[model samples]
Target: MAELVRVAALTGYFPTMQGLGADPRPMLRECGLSPELLANPEQLISARATMRLLERSAEVTGCTTLGLRMSEERALANLGVASLLIAHQPTLRLALQALTEFRNRINSTLALQIETFGEEIVLREHFALSSPEPHRQSSDLALGVLARFCAAVLGDGWTPLSVCFAHERPSPSEMAVYRRLFRCTIEFDSEFNGLVIAEADLDRSAARADSALASHARELISSVMSPAMRTASQEVEQMIMLLLPSGRATIQYCAESMGSTVRTLQRMLDADGTSFSDLLNRARMQLSSQYLANPRTRITDVAGMLGYGSIGAYTRWHSQMFGISPRQWRASAARRQPQSSAF
Candidate 1:
């Protein structure tokens, strides 16, 4: 349960493969996936496997836009029960909040956070970090699916103010497709990957919502949800992911958020066969790779994101964990990126 997404997360892969003129069966087999597996939306699969599949598909097909293609074909109903809960919420904000709250049931590894910046709301959808390389396919598919969901709830005319990606910018030809799809400005090399929605749009009533059905859906989902499937350490790690960017990923903060004292939290983690420091180390190691993958993220910023007070301290920790300076590691990753003709 490191991070699990639904096998059906690859729902669009078959069609996308057909479009790319590439046979997916071989690739699927290579990735340990198949059409039958993806047919079941509730079947849990490794998030890492999904990421690797997309990346490998892109690599093999010479189509760096593999994820975008999949996203473009994504249907809102593919979300299964979560779709029922989301479809009945009164407003887009409520629908999104419901999805975020219940996402663990669908994909325990994905993180969705909404940040309001004055009149704009940023919807951040985070997937698991699978490699040191830029996760273009992952980024595009995530944003594309988000766009589809926004359109689903806000009516066909709804569009975001901007769509952002942390990966390098696509070619002008590819950029044209993004512009057409998003119907707005697209930012590449962004610090984060997500949708930028107008604050006004979030409160707008969704056309398909049914309050009664929504309540029923909520009850159904909760009835079957095993909230404690995640260990104490896992819960704390997820909490840390949310709090780290805000400079609040401390043990005290996590304990307080969980409605427990620091000592009790420590005892609970100990009982679960992990320690608070071990959890923090694991989270930092995971997040550091993700943070460094974004070239726009400064080394100092990455340090701060990982909760280090100074660049020096972060560099020391990074060197210790990675066995190379952060700069050197990043440079190596850049050199290994696959070349595209569009480039």
Candidate 2:
């Protein structure tokens, strides 16, 4: 099943695109979405379609910063029912914790990983879409919205230590907009897409927190959670995405990560009509396509990124999957794509 995201994700999409001199309705229709659907913010829509809409809109309009533009007008209310819970947390850290806990309810495909290293905090955001399509626009939209959220909750004084993107840097003009919005250093072609924050920033108390409202919001959110909100297969797919680059995506490590034994994890997957190997293969197929389509990404690096032990193994797997070597596949993809832009 395709993961669903709330229509609220596109809160300012219409105006943002129109302001860029592009009509988003045509692209929305092309992606199986409509203005009526997006107007009903609580309605769930296909995550893949939403992502594809953003990418297509950007391409058609030649607006690389389309996502970031939409994010500029976003507010806490854009988070839908979970806004109250996230807004009332006592500190930035607590608010982020709320977001992590309720992420499935907010956007089933979205994943948040927060890690601390000494005085630095890293908040990595990922969308576990089952497709091989590029999600640059959606990724920018997410990070931009997140930056705005932190600013809204923590006050104008709050700024991340740095913002990072796994993709290459945009043009100088586009970078200016990014710098203006983030108000901090920006790193492109980095290991992940997320914010790097100072520990003190996250630890500081939130001036707007209301304990009673937070408790009430939590209750409301908890009441709506159901088994359908997430599944074992989805959880394992996310784990695979995270563990792949580390070369620890084996079933044993994945089961351990889920606090389950191999047999128990297998049972859960079996109940979901899948297995560990199947999920892993799907994840590899999705990621391999994305990585191979990027001309700058070396085949050896792609192999490493997909957790292959060696280039030969990756080559053999690629041949089996695509009936051609990685080099041929990359060449074919390059031929299909138009000339690269400055981004």
Candidate 3:
């Protein structure tokens, strides 16, 4: 099935492209989209097409940070109904929780996972589209918008410890744009794409938080969203993506995390015409493409990241699914890139 996200994903697309001296209309048509669709933020559109458009736009305009440029002007209001719920939360932690809870309504393919360790917190954002195509632009835009949201709630004094990107670093000019916006350490070609902040940052009180308004917004959202906004299979797929790197994506583990027994979860997936193994394989397929594409990642490490117990097992399975050794796939991916391109 084709994955869909809200039209709001392209909120600043038009002006951003025009600012870079390109006509975005042609790009929209190329991606099977229309300007009319951008006019309605709530409309559902093809997530893959949206990703292609952002990537192609960046290529044509020679603006490596196209997504971040579009994200510069995004305010909480751009989130529509979600803005109310998030903005009124008393703490950054709760606001982010609200954002994650209502994320499917905003962008169905986007997922956020929060991890805490000692005195730090990592806000990991994943854009899990069905295809293994590039998502660099979307990743940048999502992180940029997330930074804006955090700063909004925490006041201007907010600054994360660092921002990480799975993709390699860009040119000096592009790096300047990133440094200016994030105002912190920027790590590229990292294991993940996310923000690292002090754990205390999440507890900072929101100056504008209103319990009354938050309550009203919560009630309104509950009334508007159906209980079946996401399918059982889709939810499990999300869990698999987040847990895959940690080597704990087993059905029993996921079932326990979701507050259900393994048998009950299996029955739900049966109704959806899929199984836990099917979803796990799909997630591995998509993620392996990403991991292998990064030359800095070791094949053995990639195996561990995919939850394989040994290199031989990862190699055999990858060869069966992709018809090539992981090393050969990485070489081919590297060859496909322009020598002049930094990433």
Model number with the top TM-score: 3
Against the true structure, candidate 3 has what lDDT? 0.86
Model 1 is weakest, by summed lDDT over 10 consecutive residues, at 126-135
Error of 2 at 84 (Å): 2.6
Q: Which RMSD values do the candidates have, in order?
A: 2.7, 3.2, 2.1
Tens digits of per-residue lDDT for model 2, 58-127: 8998878888888887898888778999999999989987886667667877766676889998877766
Q: Which ranges of candidate 1 are over 4 A from the true structure?
A: 129-134, 228-231, 336-343
For each candidate, the alpha-carbon lDDT, in order, equals 0.78, 0.83, 0.86
Ranking by TM-score: 3, 1, 2
Best by lDDT: 3
User: TM-scores for all candidates?
Assistant: 0.88, 0.83, 0.91
Q: Write the per-residue lDDT of candidate 3 for residues 287-330, one digit (tens) a residue.
A: 78877776777999989978999999999999998899898888
Give the winner by TM-score: 1 or 3: 3
- Candidate 1 lands at a TM-score of 0.88
Of candidates 2 and 1, the better by TM-score: 1
Candidates sorted by lDDT, best first: 3, 2, 1
Positional deviation of residue 144's Cα in model 1 after best superposition, in angstroms = 1.1
TM accuracy, model 2: 0.83
lDDT of 1 by residue, 104-218 (tens): 6666766676888999999987553323334568767878888988899989899999988776677666666687679988887689888999999998999898989988987
